[model samples]
Every structure is written in C-alpha cells, then in structure tokens.
Target chain A: MSVLAFIDQSEGQVKKGAYEALSYAVKLASQLGTTAEAVVLGKLTDDIAALGKYGVKKIYHVADEQLNHLDAQVFADVIAQVARAAGAKIIVLSNNSDGKAIAPGLSVKLKAGLVSGAVALPDTGNGFTVKKSVFSGKAFAHVAIKTDIKIIALNPNSFSITEAGGGNAEVSAFAAAVNTPKVKVTAVNKVKGDVPLGEAEVVVSGGRGLKGPENWGMIEELAKLLGAATACSRPVADTHWRPHHEHVGQTGLAIAPNLYIAIGISGAIQHLAGVNRSKTIVVINKDPEAPFFKAADYGIVGDAFEVVPGIIEEVKKLKGVA
Target chain B: MKILVCISKSPDTTAKIAFTDNNTKFATDGVQWIINPYDEWYALVKAIEIKEKDPSAVIHLVTVGGADVEPVIRKALALGGDEAIRINADTPDSYYVACQIAETAKQGSYDLVLAGKETIDHNSASIGGMLAELLELPYVSLATKLELNGNTVLITREIEGGEESCEVNTPVVVSCQKGMAEARIPNMRGIMAARTKPLKVVEPVAADSFTGIVSFELPPAKAGVKLIPADNPAELVRVLHEEAKVI
Candidate 1:
C-alpha cells in the first residue's frame, strides 16, 4: 500500500502548502517502504509531471471543471474514492483552509483515523503514532492510530520542501461520479496584497503597540521587503486601528509559517494560540517583560518606530537595494 | 431558522498549562475551566443574532463533555440558546467529538450548525468540517458574516489573503470567527430563564475506533528577552543580524 497526498490547487496553480504536504508524504512513504503518489483535483494547467521532483512516483490528475471550486462534501467524496481506488494506507493533506474542510470529511467517509495539525512525521516502527500540536501549540500530543487506513493533515511550513533531479511521473485520470454541491459560489473577495499568508514562508505581524493606524506603513514596508504577508493583534483589530481581517489570534486566523516576525505585540495567550505553530518566532517590542518574548525564539526589546525602519533598512541592504 | 451552536469547555485563557502523573496526562488540578472564548464570542453570538432577527427562531446549544461541564452548558443557555444537549462524554478527540455532535444534529434535524473556528483547548478546527462531512452537509469555516435567504445561506469567509463568499443550501455547518458578531453576557433574567430550559443528557453513540494519546508535554520555555535600548535602533538591527540571525 502506497501513500496518497491530496495536492491543493487554486486558480489553476498548486499552492505552496501543497509542496510542503508532498515533501512530508514522500518522507512518510519512505518510512513505510512505499512510494508516495499525488491526486490533483480540478483542471490544472501546471505540469503535473513536474511534481515528481518532490518525490511522488505518480500523479493522478482528475481534470474536471466541476472540481474547480472547493465544496468540502464533493471534495471529500472524490478524495475518498481516490484513496479507495489507489488502496492507499495513508493519506496526506495540508492543514490549510481547504484541507481542514475536506480531510476530516474524508476520514469519516473512509472510517480512517485522522490527525490534523501534524508537526512531524509519524513513528512507524511498531505502531503508526503521529506527533501533533495540542492546546494551540502549548503542548504536543503523540497519537497512535489503530486503523488500517490513516489520514494526516500537515501544518503549513512544518516540513521543508526538497527537490531532486529528473523524476518523470505518470499522470492518470481519476474517473468518479461527481456530485453537484448544494453550495454555490457567490463571489470571491481576493485581498490585494504582495503575499498570501498561507503561501508566504515569512509573515510580519504588528499589534497595538504600533500605536495607531498611520504607523502601519512601516510594517507594510518591512513585509514588502521580505515578500511576506501582514497580520495584527486582536486589539489592533478590535479598536479599528486595523481591519478585523488582519487579526491573528485564537479567535482569529491560525497561521504556521517558516518565519514569524511579531512587532510591538505583547503576545497574549490568545494571540500565541493562533501563531505558536510558526517554525520560528521573532518578537520586537520595547517592553522587556512582554509575554510574547516568552514564546519567541528571538526577542528584541525596543520601540517599534525605531526598530521597524531599521530592520526594513537592513532587509533592503541584504537585497543590495539603494 | 433553527441554529445549533456547539460549545466546548476549555481551560481559562490565562490558565498555566502543566502535566500530571509523570507527564502522561494533562494536569487538571486547580485549573479553572471556561466556555471556550472563541465559541462564546463568535459562534454563540452569531446564533443569538439569528435568533434575534427571527424571534420565533430557536438556538440550541450542543456539547460533548462530562457532567461537570453542565455549568458551562447552562452558561451558554443563559446567553440565549433555547435548549441544550450534553453528549455525556469527555471529548476524547476531534473525530469522536465530531461524530457525537453529528449524531445529535442528525437526531435533532437542526437546519444549521455553528461552531467556533477551533476550540481553544485542542485548537483543532476540524470538528465543523468533519461534522458536515459525517452529516452530508455543506461546511463553511472562518465565516465573518452570514445571511440567510430562504433555504440558502450566504457566508463570507476570511481566507489567507482575502475573503470568499459562498451560498450554501440548508443543513450546513459554519465555523464562526471574530467580526461575525459581538458576544453578550447573560442578563439576570436570561440566567433565571436558563434554569427552566430543557437540558437533555445523552450517552454518546459508539464512535469509530481511532487513536489514543500516548503522552503530552509543554513547549520549552522561551529564553529571557534581550533588551536593546530604544534610542539606538541600529543596535537592535545588529543584534538581529549577528546575534539572533533573524534579519
């Protein structure tokens, strides 16, 4: 039995999280003495065969226009069918919005044990136990799935994507009955920005300590220099200093990125709950006793107005810009 | 327009997490539990808004927890839910919790199911999606705004960079987040009314066999903060580059 990975795509291109999931699945497949395969839903223009560079031996392309937009029920149905057809022992998916919507559905349909927010590869020696973050990254829990079929949704940026040379994979069409979804696409409000948070490896977040809405330009400047997405503390959003959409906390968006830079933010437990999964946290604040420093891998105690522009200048210097 | 809001009892937001019995289990000693703040702020509030819009509409609260969690369930009832259901089991895992909630929702025939994007305890935002799958219903997450037009529900969800709007037919599951609605405290009248509200306790149906937790451990304590004087911002940059290596 081989491992099957669900590759998430949007607007005809595969997302970065998809690559991370692919990388993770390949490692898991190796541990299990099997090859990893990928299943891509919807009509994609991207060369599916190129994905083999990520270690998948085969790519199953279900080029259906009906599968273009995500309907969790329909997606789950298609994935469950693909898993059964491939006789997959383990299924891997990225624990992003789409994966979170579909993986659990597929698990229930397949009666498979599922572990979401998996931070590490499974221990496959005696039993299939996976390590995952619990309590919003405050703790870790190792869970052993005692099922024939298992499903894992890897957190974004949790695994490193490695590329190898010259892998030409076979692409096959997965023929399954497509069900018309009850949900209809109304409108997609795309946030116009330099980077999407889920796809961005680096993220820069600010909090109320930035003081007011006018000072946000520096944070944006730094993020643009780094090609990162921007986020804010809940209080920033609460006070209308920033839009609610930018809030990142236990009650807001949960993001896992390679590098998270939190500026002028006192890391409240709620805020940490949302972003603690980030691979590395760099916190900048003038308050030396801020709770965020307790969770940050790197801490800089300084005022935001002074520190932000300095960092921005350094990033520009690194990029050899005037 | 019957809405069922699912709530989970979690540790207070400020609780200091620790392990017990040689780190094999979560230490619960002297820890105070509260209604998951997110659930209270988003899911329950949105449900109350719907109920207010249509006065005849009923909001039901559902949870999978032990007898001790009834106070929290009552607290939800006090918020505005007309009735409540306690699944009489500690939430063992996401799958188990989702299955039990799905079973109850199926029996109740509720038109809508609302939940917080994720429980503050496990932070596994998998339940609403899993429940929708189990019940063969549409699932929408991180919904900031929701409007119902007949049998169709319009939801706007906050994505990574932007938001997406979708229309789903009835019998759908939606996970609520901030900006959906403002949370309200229980007034004296509401609290008194909650005493007479029907709270049914049901045993969970046997869930599909699954994983068991081997152990739990806290993340390593962060190192002491490095103080860089505010006047010399360049020094902070140097520390980030040479010492911290984050820049």
Candidate 2:
C-alpha cells in the first residue's frame, strides 16, 4: 500500500544517489496515491528526520554495525522483511553496487518484478511499464512488472532531485532477523582518486595515446582543475598504465557522467558502450578517422601533448587559478 | 575440484540494436552472436585455467536455451570444458533461468559455480544471486579476481571506490567480470575434440517468471560528431562553457 525507498548510506553518510532514489520514490508514491517511506541500515551521521524534505513520511532505521559492509544476502533478507511489514507495493533503490547485488536476491525473496538500470519514470497510462537501458546503454527496454509487488533500481544521474517544503519524517528503530554472512570480508583496498567515478559529474579519460604512464601529468592536471574523475580505455588498464577500476569500456565500468572527455582513445564501439550515456562527449585524438570522433559532441584532431596543455591553460584561466 | 560455468550468446558489441513486432521482440536478422564477453573472457577462462593447473579438476558448461544455443555450448566445450548441459527451455526471466540451473547444480554437486556478471543482451545480472538463494549457497556478484585453494576461495570484488577481498567456503556462486582471467581462443585440436565431447540435454525444471517485457525501443541516435578544428582549442573550451554549460 506504500512506496519504500532504500536510501543507501556509506560510512554513516547518505550518498548523493540515494537522494535521487528517495526523490524518485516521492514522485512515484504521489502517482500511486500513497505516501512514501524510507529504510536504512546501520547508524547514520546525517539527521534522519531531515530526509522528509524528499517526501519520506517515516524513516525505518535498523541500527546494526555489522550491516556497515554490504552483504547481498543479508541485506536482501532484511529488506524483504521490511517490505512485507510496510506493505511496500513498490520498492525503489539506486542502481548502484549495493542495489545491483541486493535487488535480485530481494526479487526472488519477495517475488517482485524488478527493473534495474531504469532511466526514466514509469509510464502507467495503460499498464505499469518502466523504461531501462539495455545492451549496455545502446538501447532501451520497456518492462511491465506483472507481479503484485514491484522493485525498481534507478540509474544514478538519470533523474534530478526534488525537495518538498516544510516536511519532516519521524524516525523509529526497527528490528529484523539478521542472517550469518556466507562470505567474509577479509581485506578492503580503497582506490585513491580525486573523485569517485560513480558520482562524478565530469570525467576525463585517456587511452593508449598518452604513450606511457609517466606522461599522465596533463590529464591529471586537467582532471584536477575540473574536479572530474579520471578514466582510461581497456587497453590502458591491461597494459598497466592505469588500474582496472579506472578502465571505462564495455567490459569496464559503465558511467553516465554529465560530461565525458576522451583523449587519445579511439572511440571503439566497445569503449563507447560504457560511456555513450554521457550527456556530452569530447574527443581529442590525432586520428581524424578515430571511431570516437563519430560519437563525440566535439572533436579535436591534434597531438595530445600540444592540445591538452592548451586546453588546460584555458581551463585554468576560466577558473581564475594562478 | 569441480567447476560449473554458465555461458550465453549475445549480439556482437558493435551490432546495431533494433526491435520488431511493435518492440516486443529483438531483431536478429543479421546480428552475429558470440559468447558473452564476461563468460568467455573471465568465468570460463578462469575455470579452464584451474582445470589446466589441476588435471583432475572437472569443468562443465550449462545453458538454458533452444537448439540455436548448442553452437555456443560447443564453443564453450572447445575452450576445454569437460562436458556441457543444455536445459531445453528459453525464457528471459533471470529467476526462471536460475531455477533451472540451481536444480541441475543441486544434483551435480558442483564445488564452484561461475557465470558472467551479466549477459550483454538482457544485462539482467541477477541469475547468480537468485541461483545461490535457490541452492542455499553463498553468492558473490561481480567478482573480478578469484583464487581457489583446498576448500576455500579468495575473492576480490569492486566496490564503490575500492576493492573488497572476501573469503568463502566451497559450493559458492560467483558472477565474474574482467580481471579474473584472459580469454583464450580455441585451438584446432581443441575444436576437433569439442565436436565429440559429451553434450547432455535435459528437460528444465518448472519455474515461473515474475516479470515480462512490454516492448523495446532504441535511444535517439547521436547527431553525429561536431568537429572543432584542432587549431581552435580555445573555441572548443568556450563552447563547452558557454553553450554546453558543462564546465
């Protein structure tokens, strides 16, 4: 009878993507003629009641320290119980790492129709259908969930956030049976970067054209000035020019940043598969026939050493940085 | 050691996407299908590597599809799987597919189950988790690196901004991505041997699907590239700031 949004938090802080999911649920609840509620695991540093501005009427907090690290089965079990208790006909989540792992297990547990990587709002005029990106953002699929309960994992940066005025949610503690983890986390290795690629608005990606790893100073400078994430093509990752996490291609992380700048990387179809969703693409390759130029919103055919520094200077001037 | 690898075929990465029958079905007129990259390049490769290291290890391939999927299964065998199993059914629902695989694995008693993180076609990325639930086994999604030991495995999976290393006992399910293993092409000898390998066809278990596709549509095509002359780097930045408002 209600909509529930799983507002994922990390290190006791609500992520930016969760705000989009919460806001998305708020709109979905209004359309369904019901109120929206939110669920979070572990204690949070952010004030839970302040989330009411996103249209959540109640906040269900499961304060479990063990829940800090994401365990897919444990989360799925706990969320399924919350959904059943709240009568959540529609469950909303960000199509993120946690969401991707937990939503599928949850779908089986709740027998709910799940649509992940949803790009837009559902079209409910005739029947409930959610539009999602398929073929790695090459196409769209309109899926109709026939089950009584539904789950949606919305893609991050696809929807804008909306806030409601003078709204406050009541926070209450909820208890659910926790399961013993089947997998044990032995070590955590953090990838150090200026910005987390998943949440970055702008991304500057390089390919093998940078020649070698030592010549990456310009790309880093540009990325630092723009506050953008740094990515690389698959070959670069394979050749050890960059870490595997920074590789952005069909076989790598699929990102939809607002602006994606590709340098020296031929826009191979495989490479484009992961980044084609970027709002704007700028290609910097000396090869006029490089495949990436065809998909770029803007193209510059020149030497990376020459063109990148000039662009960096302009960006620095624009930022008024000494 | 026993390993079960799930393989699926999908359109080539560069294939143009189109839908027919009012978007109810995918267009397959001229599309060239290949084993999903994750399956071929990571899950299957890692399985074969383990088999090569331990000659006693057995690797099996499974797929749930019609006769058209046999060629793909044969290809998996060509890559050195001991045998292959085809569940005679076709459904896009990941849970239904997982149920069939779970029932098969329950009987086979596989020590490890590996599948692509997701197929390039539907991109569901759900079967591994669902299968784990059905079989009551531990599950790991998007495992980039896996190292097998006596009865336990060390796993590395990508998190939001880092890598997470996990340890799980045998009878675990893992959906693999890149960094697990390099894809190996089938040699002439392997291809010849694959033609005679055992391919067992089994009837699928009854599993109901929860979702259905209403239709399919392609995204609006790009307007093509707007070329900015190489000499005018400043102008490109100006446009990015003024027109695109991206800066």
The 0-to-1 C-alpha lDDT of every candidate, in the order given, reads 0.84, 0.88
Question: Which pairs of residues collide in model 2?
Answer: A267-A292
What is the CA-based DockQ of model 2? 0.73
Docking quality level of the chain pair in candidate 2? medium
For candidate 1, what is the lDDT? 0.84
Report the number of the highest-TM-score candidate: 2
Reference contacts recovered by each candidate, as fractions? Answer: 0.70, 0.73
Error at A20, model 1, angstroms? 0.7
> Candidate 2 on B1-247: residue-level lDDT in tens?
8899988888888888888998888899999888999999999999998987899999989999999988888988888899999999987688789889988898899999999998887877888888887886778888999998889899999777777899999989999998899878999999999999999999988888877888898877789888887777889889999989999
Instruction: Score residue B180 of candidate 1 by CA lDDT.
Output: 89
For model 2, how does the per-residue alpha-carbon lDDT over A1-322 read when each residue is reduced to its tens digit? 9999998976677877899899999899888789999999877899889999887889888888777767788888889988899989999998877787788888888988888889888987877899988898888899988889999999888888898763779987888888877788888776565687877899999999999999888988999999998999999999989988899878888899999999999888889989989999999999999998878898898988899999998898899998
Off by over 4 Å in 2: none
Q: Which 10-residue window in model 2 chain A sums to the lowest lDDT?
A: A187-196
Question: Which stretches in model 1 have alpha-carbon errors above 4 Å?
Answer: B229-247
